[model samples]
Target: MDSYICQFPGCFKQYKNRCNLKRHEEAFHTENKKFQCVHCKKILSSKQNLKEHEFIHTNQTPYVCREPGCGLRFRHGSQHSAHKRIHVAIKNIVNRSSVVSFKLSNIEEDIEEEINPKDMMDFTLPLIKRSQDYILPVI
Candidate 1:
């Protein structure tokens, strides 16, 4: 099989197909951003990127978690997936038998900030709290 390597300096990306190589160059190397956001007028490289960017102005969060009592919505699938892990960790903690193990040394810093529930009345986003901060039932 023939490989198409990108000629861009410092970019050693290789593709099996010729069209894929061209797409990579157009998307990353070239400044030919033809697609523009209708609301913000921000130029994007591709149609998909432009559509995703437009969601910010439209306030359309297509990715929603169906977890009971938590209907949090996100603009991206990655954000929604990360949010779902919180629910999984909470459930594991409650059950006690199925705790997910991880190295504490690997953690760099806390990604969440302490927030009062009363202050979050206007927002749909959940109040992220540390595991130790929660008052779990005595098991």
Candidate 2:
């Protein structure tokens, strides 16, 4: 069976059937968007794309981290899982530290110490600024 290749620039997606290829082209390459977001006036090709876009307007991030004092929320499951890994890494670092007593008082004091923003950026945590409006790309 011959595969149908997408003609879109920088997109080399291929499909086993012509119908699937057509769908992909309509979703990714076409200028006409059937689904429109009510809040941001963003246009999307499919219902699924519109649904995901709606989360940004609603500010509804259901996936929240369970760590104490860390109230980070994420819209996607993949992002949520990645944020959890940061907590795991911090926990491992604390465990391996020379502080053998592991008292709550010591941990609280350590956390209270002010760290520079540049130093915090070294950990590569997703620190989103809520003060600015995030613009979504139109399909």
| 1-139 per-residue lDDT for model 2 (tens digits) | 8989998899999887897788678878898779999997888887766776799988888788989999888886558888999999877655544344445447768976676667866777568767643222221
The top-ranked prediction according to lDDT is 2
| Per-residue alpha-carbon lDDT of candidate 1 for residues 58-124, written as tens digits (9 for 90 to 100) | 8899989999889999986658988999999988776653232232222423523555578778777
Q: Which stretches of candidate 2 lie over 4 Å from their true place?
A: 1-36, 45-49, 98-139
List per-candidate RMSD values in Å.
Answer: 14.8, 15.2
Give Cα-based local distance difference scores for all models: 0.75, 0.76
Evaluate residue 36 in candidate 2 and report its C-alpha lDDT on the 0 to 100 scale. Answer: 92
My TM-score estimates for the predictions, one after another, are: 0.46, 0.39
Q: How does residue 120 of candidate 1 score in lDDT?
A: 70
